[model samples]
Target: MMTQMMDILGPIMVITAIGFLLGRSSIGFETRTLSTVVILVATPALIFNTLTSLDITPETIGTMSSAALLCIAISGALGLLVLVMARSSVRSFLPPIMLPNSGNMGLPLVLLAFGPEGLQLGVAYFFVVSVVQHSVGLSIYAGGLQLATIARQPLLYSVAAVLLVTWTDMPVPNIVMVTTEMLSGMMIPAMLLLLGTSLATLKVTDLRPALLIAVSRLGLGILSAVFVIAFLDLDGLTAGVVFLLATMPTAIVNYVYAERFQHNPRQVAGSVVTSTLVTFVCLPLLVWTALGISERGSGADAQLSQAMTRTETSLGATYTND
Candidate 1:
């Protein structure tokens, strides 16, 4: 278990660690430019490529969508409850607790642990979360409902294009597919690198609030994931993918939003860093549990197949005698 865990998560950490070291060194780079490239170029290409190329069935989309929405809704509600009890601003706390680093951490982790199908499902969940983060999460910070920003994001258009192409069964040229795949390939490493850079730049002033929010994010997320999987009857790879995604830490975008809106950026930054640190503990456990479930599920399937084969053999012998 330990070896498997390290093998799966080690590469992710190594890449991020490189970025972290660079971030801390005299070496400097424009984080905004990197973020823009990721958000506008790499991410759109990745989403477009995955949505168009993967065998994303209605069942798969529906299950992943349900899990994403349910997880966010449950986490947001719990965060709101805590904020109200503590007399804290929802704007300052909820987004950090509700939103997660699905892009940076969730996507790559799922891809590594569960393969392409898992990556496809992870993207579906990520899309749902991104849409909500831009619209609903933005509104929470701005103190008003905002949908225009969501409409303006390049990702929205990319998703639309992919859906149109998929629905029409358009034959994309090999060059286009290859180009998009090449661009998409950069997203995971860039995202992890960006995560490390973001963490390095962040300064934590309010450790108490940061720790509280971090713990709440992970705790609420796990509970919500359990309910979502059970309610949706999600099993096997889908269940595991959704659960790990649910447990992802505060998104880097949350800090961006917090800084933009002046919603306690320091505290938000602290939460982002602290929650990510906690993932070093929580994520492995989630991965281990998910793999165990997959193993048991396969065993049951094999047993069922054997039973059906024995029944067919019995019936065949009876017919031959007749």
Candidate 2:
């Protein structure tokens, strides 16, 4: 189990460390340009390629999407309570608490831990989170619903195209498939590198308030995921994917939004940095727990199948004897 955990985490840490080193060095890169490319090009391609290529059922996709939504709702509710009690700025802190780093941190973790199928599910969860974050999350910061912003997201189009193809059983052009596959390859590594770079750049001001919010984010996240998983009776890869993605740290994007809107960006940045640091410490335990849930669920399924087969065989023999 330890070896498996290391196998999953080792590559992520190494790549992130390289990015952190680069961030500390004099090397220059356009963070916005790279972020735009990932969001508009590579990520959409990754989602389209993964969903279309996988033989996953629509029911499974819906379940994952629903789980994602539920996690957000629960987290938001719990976060609102905490914010109100603490008398914090809802606009500044609530977004960070409700939303998570499902893209930068989540995709790679799920892929490494659960493989391609896990990546597929992770994409689904990321898709839902992205939609909500851009829509409702943006509204909280901007003080209004940003319909234009939501409509402009490439992820929405990518998911729409996926559904169209899936429903019609249409064959995507070979060239398009090849192109998306190529673009999809770069998405995860780019995200991880960006995560490390962003972490390096962000400053944690006011450790007391920052740590309070950070702990709230992680705690509400885990509680929300647990409640949703149990309420929805999710298990196996689906449950693990939901749990990992749901429990991710406060998104770096939240700080960006806060800075853009002048909504206490410093405190938001502090939360982002501190929450990510805390999550790194807890990741091994999270991975272990997720893996255990998956294994136990799979084992239960296998046992049930065996029991049904035995029952059928016993009934057949009894009828023969009669």
Candidate 3:
């Protein structure tokens, strides 16, 4: 188990470290361009391919979707309290605490830990985060609800297309599917490398608030995941994925939002760097713990077991069966 956990985390740390080193060495990689490519090209293809290819039913989608929304809502609720206590603006603080790095870090971690089915489920969670971040997160940062921003995200369109194809039993042309599959392959590594580069550029002027918020985000996330999993009856891989995601650090993009809105960019950058470094130390233990808990089997565990059994029985294919 320890070895497996290490295998999952080892490459991530190494790749991110490389990016960090490159940045420190004054090697100029156009991170803004890379970020745009990831968001506009690689990530959307990955999302579309994952969603379209997965053999998930509406129940599975609902379960994952519920988990995602619950995750965000609970985090946001706790963040509201934190904001009140800190007496800070939503623009400066709420986003980092409320939104986990579901795309760059959370997705890759789950993909490694849980495999393709797990990645599919992770995408479901990412979908909700993307929608919420583009819409609600933007609104908070922009000081008003920018409904139009949601329409501008390529992921949103990819999601819609994937859903339409999934629901209608429509056949995607082979060429398109192949193209997306090729692009999807690039998503994880690119995101991780991009993460390192982004970390390289982050400047932390104040460690006190950054550390406080970093701890608060991770601490509140665990509490929220526990409540949400039990309340929503998620178990097995789904529960494990939720728990792991709950432990993820703040998104690097929050700094972008902070910088765009002039809302304490240094503080946001500090939180990003602090939480990401903290994630490096915490992820292996957290993943191992989640796997152990899921294996022990409870309410959600039983459901997940039964669901996997049904899937395997019906399809004659193996599943995670843990």
Candidate 4:
């Protein structure tokens, strides 16, 4: 189990460390430009390539997406309850607790732990979270519903293109596939680097509020995912993917939104940094736990299949004797 955990997290830690070092150094790279490239180009290409290449059905995607929504809703409700009880600012703390770093931290972990099929499901969940973070999460900060935020996401277009191709049974040209694949290859590493650099830049102003939010985010987030998995009867690879994505730390975007709206950005930044640090400490256990759930679920499925076969054979034998 320790070896497996290292295998899953080693590459992520190494690349992110490099990014953190670079951020600490006087390297004058334009983070905004890199972020724009990721959002506008690489991310969309990655989503398109992964979804189209895989044999994932729309129903499977829908199920994962629904799970994502439910997890977010449950996490948000839990966070709200805690904040209300503590007399905290719901607008500032709620978004960080509810939304997660599904894009930056989640994709690489899922890809490493569960491989291509898990990536497909992770992408579906990420897509849903991204949409909600931009719309509903933004509204929470902006103090108004910003449904228009969804229309601006390139992820929306890529997913639409995927659905169009899937429904129409259109064959993608080899060149397009190759191009997207090449672009998609950079997505994970770039996002990891971005995560590390972003973390390096964030300052934890007040440790108390930050720690409170961080603990709430990870605790409520994981519990919420567990409830959703059982509630939705999710098992195997799907359950693992959902669990990992849901348990990620507060997203950097939450800080961005808070800074933009002047809604306690420092506190949000502190939460992002604190939660990420805490998540790293908890990652090994989390990975082990997720893998265990998947394995047990798979075992349960195999047993059920074997039992059903045995029952069928017994019925056939009795009918023949009759």
Q: For this target, which candidate reaches the highest TM-score against the unseen true structure?
A: 2
lDDT string for model 1 (33-125, tens) is 988998889988998899888877656666788899999999999999988997777878898889888899999898989889889989989
Candidate 2: residue 12 lDDT (0-100): 90
32-131, model 2: which lDDT tens digit per residue? 8888899899999998999998886677778888999999999999899999999889988998999999999999999999999899999988999988
Cα error of candidate 2 at position 284, Å: 0.5
User: How much is the lDDT of residue 65 in candidate 4?
Assistant: 85
Minimum summed lDDT over a 10-residue window in model 1 is located at: 303-312
Candidate 3 residue lDDT tens string, 1-322: 7789778888888888777777777667777888889888998898888888878766677788888888888889988898888887666889899888888888888888888988988887888787787788877888987767667899888988877887788988989989999998988888888888878888789987787678777767776777787788766788888878877889888888888988898999999998887676656666766675567566554554443334224322211231
Query: How badly does each model clash, as a count of residue pairs?
Result: 0, 0, 1, 0
Where does candidate 4 stray beyond 4 Å?
147-149, 298-322
What TM-score fits each model? Answer: 0.89, 0.91, 0.90, 0.90
| TM-score: model 2 vs. ground truth | 0.91
Better of 2 and 4 by lDDT: 4
User: Between 2 and 3, whose TM-score is larger?
Assistant: 2
Q: CA lDDT of each candidate?
A: 0.81, 0.84, 0.79, 0.85
- Candidate 4: residue 301 lDDT (0-100): 47
Cα lDDT for residue 308, candidate 2: 30
Model 2 local distance difference test score: 0.84
